[model samples]
Target: MKYRYFLILFTFFTILGACNQPISQTSKASAKKVINAAPEKKIPIDTSKAFKFNDNWVVPKSSLDFNSLGDSQGDTLKLAVCGDFVYSPFGTIKDSSAFSSSLLKNFSIVTRTEKMDNGTFNFQILNHGSSKLIFFFDTDPEASRHSDIFKGEIYDEDVQFVNGIRIGMSFPNFYKTLFDSFPDDLTNNYTVVQIISCVDDIIQTYDFDAGKLKSVKFITDSYWKVDY
Candidate 1:
């Protein structure tokens, strides 16, 4: 009878120990899962001084006119004015011999050569002037491709387009301001905004992807007609 009582006590202790073991293991597993599933902290963005300006702040003007502006207009467009400038078939007019000298005087040129699939070559001039102007050119001399400014980009706040349109302006503000200033030049398909200049035979395209001004492109009518 004593042995039977001892056997019953052993069985009771064994079951209690099994229950306690699972309880402790389950608690540890739950704690591990909680730690693993914890969300990571995120850094907050400060927007208080987002639109503040520094000393180099350039107040954008209202509009730019080709006829009235003279050589200043040519300087702004990075194109050579009439006088001794030779016109290229690609729509660029400059004294090719004096091109390097002129660029040296005005811009710090960083040239990048790129080869095309058709065995032709091209050059990209980055940070051309204070406006961060980028110019694309055909580099091959033997080929019909003229060494001319095929494309240009402007992203500097100091360089403003017609009617206060600038680099950092919001899409809504730019569109509204541009339309308010030059209503005739504005055209949009909701995806792209374009300001066409019949006088220069050039189109200035504004790309506002992230609700802000992303980039501005100036392409010749020849390019827009043939390639674009």
Candidate 2:
């Protein structure tokens, strides 16, 4: 009888040991899976004063339709302007018959600086035959060896006019904002800032003698360069 009891106890212990072995294997597998999981990549948050200036600067939107004080002349042949110093191919020479001869130019994005800062960008007005137009840079470039011929790509001036024009700016000097600001990792070519612009037909007018000219506005699909 004692021998039989010993045999039963031995079998019970063997079964228990077998069960515990699998538990150990399961725990090891679970730990290994957790170790293989990836960690979240960290993004460098921009907290600089220069970026704050962009807050005060009016990032122009497509909805900012250049308005007119009154009806912009009905049935008159109108020409639309793009944000990137581009004009409608339709000459504003003021002649209905002139409509018969018109060429379309595609809109493209080009960088321009504002009149306020004469540094890399110059905020200047262009006087094309008595009509005045404003130009500003979407991108603020750093001091370059060459003239601020921006590194950002530009739409060729030769392209034909399309339905709309788009303009955007990239701040290449995102890290140079301030002292306490997080250091900018130059290795990562990041787009720290951006602005999108579109061009649309604005209020038309005649000689300044009839000067009711309020503003010129237009619509665009995206940044002038996004040629899809």
Candidate 3:
């Protein structure tokens, strides 16, 4: 009878020990699933700072329109202009002049001519004293028959695009701010990313070198280089 009682006591202790054991693998997995099933909270995007600037820079607004001058009427025309500069097929032009004496007064202008198969093409480069900024102008009225020729590089911090892009800005932040996506690694050569406007006729190119913006090109797709 004592042996029987002892056996019952031993069985009771064994069951209690089993109850104290760690949870099963299946129970752990179920708990993990329950935790993972909870909805994740998302951060709201700030519309005010999304694509806006306080400066005088203007963002191009697109409107429904077709390229009237192009061969295909269905092709959309995207022309980007920043401040006083207008983009064309050849280059960017400022103040609607290939060589503006009023604007060039502050800077030294160097003019040169290139002999082409059909004719001679004129080119001009404007340089400021001790400034790294340079502007290249196409002076050939016949070569750029559609628009004036002007291309420039901006190294000033005071100058900022409408989307808050500026020289020396980090590539990741610029990419995230402009595109809202993570940027890929850029090589030594400048990585060119073109921004096309849907609502307006505007196409802008941002060139990044060494993880910073090197230059910006505003292009008008409607214009093409005049065959010499």
Q: Order of candidates by TM-score, top first?
A: 3, 1, 2
Error of 2 at 63 (Å): 9.0
Question: RMSD of model 1, in Å?
Answer: 18.0
lDDT of each: 0.45, 0.30, 0.46
Candidate with the greatest lDDT versus the true structure: 3
Local distance difference test, candidate 1: 0.45
Indicate the residue-level lDDT of 183 in model 3: 16
Candidate 1 lDDT over residue span 1-228, tens digit each: 999999999999999988877557888999999999999994442333121122211121233221221222211212122211112212333433444444223445565555555554434354544444334443446644232545567666555442456677876686465222222122222335554442454555666656667677766644322121
Candidate 1 Cα outliers beyond 4 Å, as residue runs:
1-150, 156-159, 181-189, 222-228
lDDT of 2 by residue, 1-228 (tens): 999999999999999988877557788989988988868786553433112221321111232231221222332322232333222312331222232343212222233443333334343222322223333333435622111111122232232222232121122221222122332342132222121222232222211112221222222332222111
TM-scores of the models, in the order given: 0.32, 0.20, 0.38
Query: How much is 186 displaced in model 3, in angstroms?
Result: 12
Top TM-score: which candidate number? 3
Error of 3 at 147 (Å): 12
Give the higher-lDDT candidate: 2 or 3: 3
Least lDDT summed over 10 consecutive residues: which range in candidate 3? Answer: 64-73
